[model samples]
Target: MLGVRLDTELEERLANVARTQGRSKSDIAREAVRRYVELHDEAFRREARRQSQRASRRDTQEDYAFWEQAEREDAAWR
Candidate 1:
């Protein structure tokens, strides 16, 4: 359960939309909130995936450098 307070102008706009659509205000508000949450959730997930990919690339580069250094040391001992 949630409560929302709207100013007069916005409230009137909502009322008009609700009336034209033959839907209750609560229904419209609920759908709007649901869509908003979904949109942001997807955006958050995309950012997380991007960060993970960047970290993976950094690790791969570090691993390659470490192996290259080890190879150089081995050649020096031969």
Candidate 2:
């Protein structure tokens, strides 16, 4: 249950669109909000995935470096 305030000009535009589309302004607003939420949700998911991939790559590189150093130390002992 949310109330939105639109300016006079915008209100008229919305009214015209609603009249032509044979739909209520509330319906149009609801669909717009739904799409907005979905778009941002997908963007958030993509960023999270990218961050996870970056962290995984960093961890893999660190592990490789550690093993390489260990190998060098072992060769020196031999």
Highest TM-score among the candidates is held by which one?
1
lDDT of 2 at 60: 78
Residue 69, candidate 2: alpha-carbon lDDT: 100
lDDT of each: 0.96, 0.95
Q: For model 1, how big is the CA root-mean-square deviation?
A: 7.4
TM-score of 1: 0.75
Instruction: Give the alpha carbon lDDT tens digit for every residue of 1-78 in model 2.
Output: 999999999999999999999999999999999999999999999999999998877867789899999999999999
- How many backbone clashes are present in model 1? 0
Task: State the lDDT of candidate 1 residue by residue for 13-77, as single tens digits.
Answer: 99999999999999999999999999999999999999999987786878989999999999999
Error of 1 at 13 (Å): 0.3
At residue 2, give the lDDT of candidate 2. 97
